[model samples]
Target: MSHEFTVETGLVAFSVGGRAQFGWLDLVTGSFHSEADGQCINDAIVAVEFSSDVVH
Candidate 1:
C-alpha cells in the first residue's frame, strides 16, 4: 500500500512495507529516494543530532 502527503510545492508518497520497510518519493525530482528496513529514518535522526551537538 501507499500513502501520500500534501506538501507546499507538490505531493510526497511513501510505499508501505511489512513491519518497518518503507520507501519515499522525491517530489521535486520525481524519484524514489530510499527504502528503509527501519534504519534509514533512525540514521537520519542521528545525523541531525550530531550536526546540532555543537553549542554556539
Candidate 2:
C-alpha cells in the first residue's frame, strides 16, 4: 500500500502591530526598516521574510 499527502503554504507576520509595514524597497536602496518597532531591523531582509502560518 502507498499513501500520498500534500502541503499548503501561507504568509505569516514576522513583525507585530504596525511593524508589519515595510518601507519602500528599491534596487538602489540597500537598506530597509520598519517605521513602527524596527523589529529585526539589522537582520537580513530575506531571513525574516516568512514566518510560516502552518504549524508544521
Candidate 3:
C-alpha cells in the first residue's frame, strides 16, 4: 500500500478472507510471505521497534 517502503510499513497489510494479516515482509518486497521467507509479524515489529535487523 502506498508503495512498499519502510515509511509505508505502518500502512501495509494483506486482507485475506476479510481478516487483517501482517504477512512476511522484506525491505524490497514489503508485506508478503514465502516458504522460509522473512520474519513473521511479531518478529518484524520487534525488529523495527528495536531498530535491529534480523540475523539471518
Best by TM-score: 1
TM-score of each: 0.25, 0.24, 0.24
lDDT of each: 0.31, 0.36, 0.38
6: Cα error in model 3, Å: 4.0
Q: Candidate 1: how large is its RMSD?
A: 12.9
Per-residue lDDT of candidate 1, residues 1-56 (tens digit): 39666212211223343232234434564444333331233222111111234444
Task: For model 3, name the residue pairs that clash.
Answer: none
Quality of model 1 by C-alpha lDDT: 0.31
| Model 2 worst lDDT run, 10 consecutive residues | 5-14
Model 2: which residue pairs collide?
A: none
Encode model 2's per-residue lDDT on 1-56: one tens digit a residue. Answer: 29542212222223433334443222244444443453434443341344445555
RMSD of model 3, in Å? 9.9
Higher TM-score: candidate 1 or 2?
1
Q: What does candidate 3's lDDT look like per residue over 1-56, in tens digits? A: 67654432322443433434434345664544422444454323322222225533
- In candidate 2, stretches whose alpha carbon ends up further than 4 angstroms from where it belongs are 1-27, 37-40, 47-56
